[model samples]
Target: MKTIDCLGDMCPIPILKAQKALKLSPSGTTIKVVTDHSCTLESMLNHFKKYEITSTEVINGVWEIFITKS
Candidate 1:
């Protein structure tokens, strides 16, 4: 698993970072994204939906999105 910390990053930064991580990660790899922005999560959901990846909230207050690359 790869971990990405996007805390305090606004808007598209988190989403963009997630995208980069996904591209760099191998197939079937799991990437963990930590962010405080809700909009980032929404955008991530939309972006990963095509890959059928799901994001899980691991911690409260801060959002932890888990993406498994297919």
Candidate 2:
């Protein structure tokens, strides 16, 4: 699993990074996205509908979103 740290990033930055990772990585790769903004989480959840969301957990106001490439 690879981790994309978007703790301070906003909007398309995180999504863009994820998209780049997906494009570069092979299929079935698992990624963990760490974000502190709700909007980022929401955007990811909505944008990554095509991928498999392994899990989402909010701890101490930070969200950890896990997705597996299909």
Candidate 3:
């Protein structure tokens, strides 16, 4: 899985990074996104809601989103 770290990034950055990664990745690929911002997480989920989101959970207090290209 490819990982995009958006720890200190705010709105749009995380989404942009995810977009870039998705564009480069093939269909059915799974990517892991790490973000510390709550708004980012919500925005990401909302923005890419059409894609397959495998999981959204907090690990060690940080939010992690797993999305699969479809």
Q: Model 2, which residues run further than 4 Å from truth?
A: none
Best candidate (score: lDDT): 2
**Which 10-residue span in candidate 3 carries the lowest summed lDDT?**
53-62
Residue 4, candidate 2: C-alpha displacement in angstroms: 0.6
Return the clash pairs for model 2, or none: none
lDDT of each: 0.82, 0.87, 0.86
Q: Kindly indicate the candidate among 1 and 3 with the higher TM-score.
A: 3
Instruction: Order the candidate numbers by lDDT, best to worst.
Output: 2, 3, 1
Question: lDDT tens digits, residues 1-70, model 1?
Answer: 8999999999788878888988998898888888888788888888778665556666776888888888
TM-score of 2: 0.89
TM-score of decoy 3: 0.88
- For model 2, what is the C-alpha lDDT against the true structure? 0.87
* Model 2 C-alpha lDDT per residue in residues 1-70, reported as the tens digit of each score: 8999999998889999999988888999988989988898789889999998754656776888888998
Q: Tell me the tens digit of each residue's lDDT in model 3 across 1-70.
A: 9999999998899999999999999999989999888887788779998898754657655788888999
How well does model 3 score by local distance difference test? 0.86
Kindly report which residue stretches of model 1 are placed more than 4 angstroms away from their true locations once superposed: 56-59
- How well does candidate 2 score on lDDT at residue 29? 95
Candidate 3: the clashing residue pairs are none
